[model samples]
Target: MSEAVPLPAGTTLGKSFEYGIDINLGTSAVPEWQPFRRISGFQPTFTPTTQDAQTYDDLGADNSDVTGWSFAIAFNVQVNRNTATGLYLPEIEALLARTRPSAKGEAAVVEVRWYHKPEIGTPNPADAGQGRATVAITRQNTGPNGEIEVLSVTLSGKGPYTEIANPFDGWDSTVAVIGTVGPEGAGDGDLVTITGTGFLGTTGVSIDGASLAATDYTVVSGATIIAALPAGDAGNVPVIVTNAAGASAPHTFTRGA
Candidate 1:
């Protein structure tokens, strides 16, 4: 009899539904990302433009060189309208408004961002992409009797897509809360343990506007950080923690005697 091998821990298959798409309703300088709701069958395609590379030297092998890339995403959403509010879903409204004949050139183009949803209880960052795309909406056939109305929306890439940090990564709600720092009064080179919540991905620690060296701080967990105090004025200085999301509110830390 053959011995059975055990599967590795944390092994799980990726689900097709574990992806999200967002449309930017605001400008590049001030982006407001609104997720597409009630969507299904989200599909993204990256097609490469290739050029014939096979020459007289090659006998019968077919070969080509990739020249460029193109991206597009398609998804279907159930038509939803709030009767009381007399409003359609933001994403649906945006799509319908942009596809109008009056909407031309830049007016028809919208910024888009998409990401792979991160797994629960894991600190893994989301893989994301950003670019501009034009929306196309098509009405789907109504099913026999009970099927709800649906619209298929396709986003055609207007230009090149670029990879970026997931803007919707749950870090915004994980702002570090400074509960307390041991040794209320400490000076330069003093090791201080910071007790707080949401300190997992701390990027920088600053005291009185002076940032600590990267090697001076260690994020032990989501609720603890050990850092060497940087030299600062002798007073109640503000200590702030910054992460991928943003900067946390400054917590007063007594410095010196």
Candidate 2:
């Protein structure tokens, strides 16, 4: 404010975009208590935060430094295709004017935003996966009445795999993967095939909770596989298929002498 100023008693001041007496002034002494202009025009370009860093610091000093004040500008921002996957920053600006960086401007915290992604009509199957499973043990054959070992598992899926979990934490009979000796009514020497997707990649086998290496195997397709019977105690044991992706539904085979 430089000097006293006066306007007609009925004069409207500060109101812009709505109403105002256009008072072109070189200097003025008055209170700026109202909006001078309706905010419009080119807003700052910003990125929506998404798994990305976002921060801005702006300040200036001059007492020959004015006190600190924060400026807020708003605009519309775009959202990512995967809404739940990340964070995005739609608008950004240099926090401080380069000419005056010493002044202080404080913001409590960056306002977080969760813009909705494009509506996906069909949901990803993976969202419905990871269901609880039940496993049952049928039988296990011992070579000399001693327990057998379980080596590894293989797996396959219907579509692109996202996640897999192994429930067996390693309790010998329950935690370990069980292998099959043969179908029901087959003697221990009879060959029994363990069927399922992702069986070919099985580098090892398990029987009655013991980890054992495979003898011979074949990859029938990207999905199907056939593996030779592993040497172990003769019996039927639940078989678990597994791979890097994860384990498969538990199956069973019969082994007897």
Candidate 3:
């Protein structure tokens, strides 16, 4: 292959051939069996501020040349189109007075995916925290009746966050309000159906504590607590389910008659 310039001396060597070949290429990086993660920062927020939440940061480095076990994080995300469609939990709220001298502790939940179509669009991933972060995230909505709302929520970019914002507070998940205990061995009032769990504005019902002016009962999802068998006597009866963010700790039922 003598330098690429002049080559026509004798014009007769003998044989020159490059047999059996096919070519097609286009690759820079991100393919070695693909399996890597290490995200230590990310903070995106927008809950009705005319949609605009940007400024990102990331961290992660451990290649050992090729593979010895690697963790990685690289970030730059902020999608704004008034961002809000539900499920944006980024609570790996780092608590690192962390002085990892060399190595002996690791909190891993490295997963970052951000996709929002607004041009060159298509990047959707909202989940950060597997080792523990207040698990902060919520921007949910789904059409009609009371019209659910939550649009734009992402917070977990490592802290001692002296306080840009810290303290994840959200209550609307009381899960447990079921009813079906009537006319069998009956003890108190016997008119059953007091399913309760954060029973939204549920004015009254009391079994073993005895305070029932009586209303029939039907509350389904402040975490359910349905009652209607107050003539008690079968064993295991401690029923307590109230709301306004209060009573919920006596959910045991076994008094059928």
Candidate 4:
């Protein structure tokens, strides 16, 4: 009989949308990572430039040496702007601004970064790549009647991409942090206010590793969450907040008798 193989715990299949791309509209000195949003059919290609190294020694086989590499990303974006801000998407604005006639040498280049967005873990430094790229925009034909306008944008990498940390990992809306839970000694079934940044898309709240039901918690704002405490021992227990990005570090909270 064949033996059964054990798979690693917590293994998960990644989704197509688990990748993220961001462009820095600001300068290198002061970078502002604006997400490339509303994009469809996101495709990134990396090709290696190779030189044939076949010599007399290799009579039939072929050999080549990798000389260089090129990277580029192509995607389509629907024409739209923020309703409240009344401004086009940052990425669209950046690309259009760079295409202007007055945009000379350096102004024509854009800094870009891409990374694998883990569903429930902290950012891994090795999972991201960043580099400079020149933009090419082609406006697609307007559809017959009511279709929205669309633009195809391509970013041709200027040089090699360097691995780096995910820029969005430190953003307030991405990394959940527990600042304070009011009524520190509240017992089970008692409502406690959780004040912290990065609570915008909170997914779960837990006390000492015991997760509270979704109905037991309400995310009031990006910096606050109202949740009833779960049953725990009468003592200090760690409170954690989790979001799509990852779970926050445990914050010690006391439970009243």
lDDT agreement with native, every candidate: 0.77, 0.30, 0.33, 0.77
Better of 3 and 4 by TM-score: 4
Lowest lDDT 10-mer window, candidate 2? 19-28
Clash pairs of candidate 1?
Answer: none
TM-score of each: 0.66, 0.25, 0.20, 0.61
Clashes of 4: 0
lDDT of 4 by residue, 208-236 (tens): 88877756887666677898887777888
Give one digit per residue, the lDDT tens place, for model 3 in 95-125.
1111223323333212222222111211111
Quick one: best TM-score, which candidate? 1
Give lDDT: candidate 3, residue 136. Answer: 31
C-alpha displacement of 248 in model 3, angstroms? 0.8
For candidate 1, lDDT tens digit of each residue in 133-217? Answer: 9888888866788778899989999867987554443524566788887687788789988888767545678878987765578
